[model samples]
Target: MDSGLGEGSSGYSTMDDYESLISTTDAELLKRAWRNEKAAPQILRYEAALVQRSREQIKLMEETVEEFTSSGVDPLTVSLYQMDLDRTLFLLRSYLRVRLQKIEKYMFHIRKTTELWNHLSRAEQNFAERCIEDMEQHMQQSVLSKLPSSYKSHLKQSSSSEEDDMVPEPKLDTYVICRSKKFLGAFQLDDRQFLSIQCHLLSWRMNSFIFLMSMNFWTVLKTLLTLKLMIYTLYLISL
Candidate 1:
């Protein structure tokens, strides 16, 4: 979620919903993080605390599985526990793998961009640095070595280039399909422009309005009965 946006309203409606969300298991949190990372066009903020807790949980589960195996616990129970452990491991691994893929794909752009670079975890930052070093060396040997000195720079097409035009950056202008949990009416794009966004699936440019799609800002209000009824109808149709 974009920390820059003010907390207009929470996605959760009641104390019970908030409690339920906060009480979610680390495994579930990891799954959500994994899905979000996969769907996002650019890299997302690292879930450092959630990842650490998940790792600790995995270690404990591994030890428990080993003990259960040695003690000859019920076969079905042990198998179920093993399955849960495997699923959690897969989620964590997949999440990290997706981040690594994004880092690799945009290593040069990420390193040069402060906001994107700061979003990475320390380990991911190290990985990106190493990746940049390796890529530069490889480019020099395999491609840049044969080019003239003016075109030898890894991040530029030529020495005369104004910027790192050769670097691969994420496509912020790309349109994305997103859904909001709550109805946010008449979002202003500029001083004279506004867009009405009821609770529905929307297609918009990622660069222009990503903050509106943040889960944290999907706030609910009780003031729009007509809109609520329409949304309820849409939900029923969807079901």
Candidate 2:
């Protein structure tokens, strides 16, 4: 499938061939995404249109990969789709990572805001701290939940590689999570006071951001999910 089952294979461009294989809507979505343009149904917000476009492309690509695999395409072809999807996912994940870093900064800001607020003499400080905690919790919840279910579940399933199938091994590192739990024990703040807010004001700003990223979050780059998607697509194609 990479070169092909053929006499004309030497003349073909892989990019062009694969482009044709893509669904027209997927192609349009991708084209617009790359162009970073605003277009129809306004399915994506103007600021996030490109990201949504890219995500739509991947979703459609996943569907196409499924169709190919199910049709009994050779492993080589499957490999191409896999690699293409992998690359796109890599980009998507990279974008998410960048956003996550921003979220991290904002989280720090939320803490810092209150930390500074805590330094104030009296009523103002308490009011600010309460606001900050409420904002932080809301921001965390919104970002965490907004990620696509299909993309998220797919990632969880595809955590390992085909190469790893060669050996039996413990799946996760024990220390990281354990250490995190320990860290949580050290921070003492009001839990309910942490939650309640009059308007959810500051957090709503963060919510807007999470809303934007949710439309474009890159869980697709996760190899495990990619593999699972491929296998599922293959099944669909076969049907």
Candidate 3:
């Protein structure tokens, strides 16, 4: 199987070099970003630079397609370019939509957690803030207004509650498939256990193991979803 790495390349290079070799196109980078976003249970750091470049490229492609149409380019050729543009647009939109869904599901948890809050882009932060406001208002008017003051706080179950136990959090203890370009032998999982990353395959079974995501695994990172995750990702794709 061709890994898309250069032909006859051997020995490990630096992570930067490896990533550069594989992600030679904006479309490839965007595809990887979309996969990583959809696979992870939690919201990831926004791919601001990649998003910007994709948008710019999409705009240029749109203009090029328009030019081709006006200049009487072959119908088949113009349609191909249009199809490529549509795919990129779909990826960008799908990536943003996934983040929105995660935000809506875990807005309270993400807002209170500084680390997660920092992962959102400014536009996403604004959207989350508005979502929180709307949710609080809806709850206040529809139900919380009739409840006792002790139970009115949305973040907590009751006045006596010591923490925001009502807030939903991401399930970190889930499996996600990660692929690595480099051949790794006996990759250590812990002091007592080890795993292999050969043939570009890995089944990482927790967000806690994300620390092992270094440069080699960074190249062409994509996920193979479990059954539950497959359904979830399919739902996102359908949107």
Candidate 4:
């Protein structure tokens, strides 16, 4: 008699454990474990296709502008590629952000339902992680393109410019996220991480306005002081 089925069942405990293990890898199990709206393979494929087309268009624009004669991947053409890549990346990243937000909510429900930390099977987790990693890699490429050529890393897969790419490229910082429920503020756990909040950090227009206002105020103050000085000089001359 197995205790799993209350002393009367034979292999129920063993069967239960096996079922738990199988669910992680099984597509149906993954569907149940996944928090967000069921994302179809077709949707992911469609996103990939759009990204590919954007890349091709940029490459074509670059080639056409140069009549395909340029030996070097023109930096201008690279800019076009970087922009399209950035746009796609931004869209995908936003989607992931929304998903992550929802995950926190699903996590509580999943906790009550599943005994596992990683609810899905290892294979499924790996596949999802790979997709995330691909997005991160494209982001890295986008960052590198925007940076000065000298700042681009000499990766193992880099084409042809190993010699010029020699002068040690600058490294972007890694990110570490620390989830704190009590603090209620989302922030990087470590300063070592690169933050995507640069745009949100400060208002450029506000800073520019302050800079211009100060310049104008100083000019007016100087003009008023000069007029006062001239008036005093005339009085002194009259005396």
Candidate with maximal TM-score: 3
lDDT of 2 by residue, 76-173 (tens): 98889888787677665554443333333333332344442242334333544565567547754765356655323211323343332322221111
**Candidate 4 global lDDT:** 0.33
- Between which residue pairs do clashes occur in model 4? 24-121, 174-193
- Clash count of each predicted structure: 0, 6, 0, 2
Q: How high is each candidate's TM-score?
A: 0.70, 0.29, 0.73, 0.21
Model 3 has an lDDT value of 0.68
- Residue 35 shift from truth in candidate 1, angstroms: 0.7
Each candidate's lDDT (Cα)? 0.65, 0.36, 0.68, 0.33
Model 2 TM-score, 2 decimals: 0.29
Number of clashes found in candidate 4: 2
Candidate 1 ranges beyond 4 A from true positions: 1-23, 180-239
Model 2: how far is 28 from its true place, Å? Answer: 15
User: How many angstroms is residue 116 displaced in model 3 relative to the true structure, after the best TM-score fit?
Assistant: 1.0
Candidate 1 at 100: error in angstroms? 0.4
| Structure candidate 3, residue pairs in collision | none
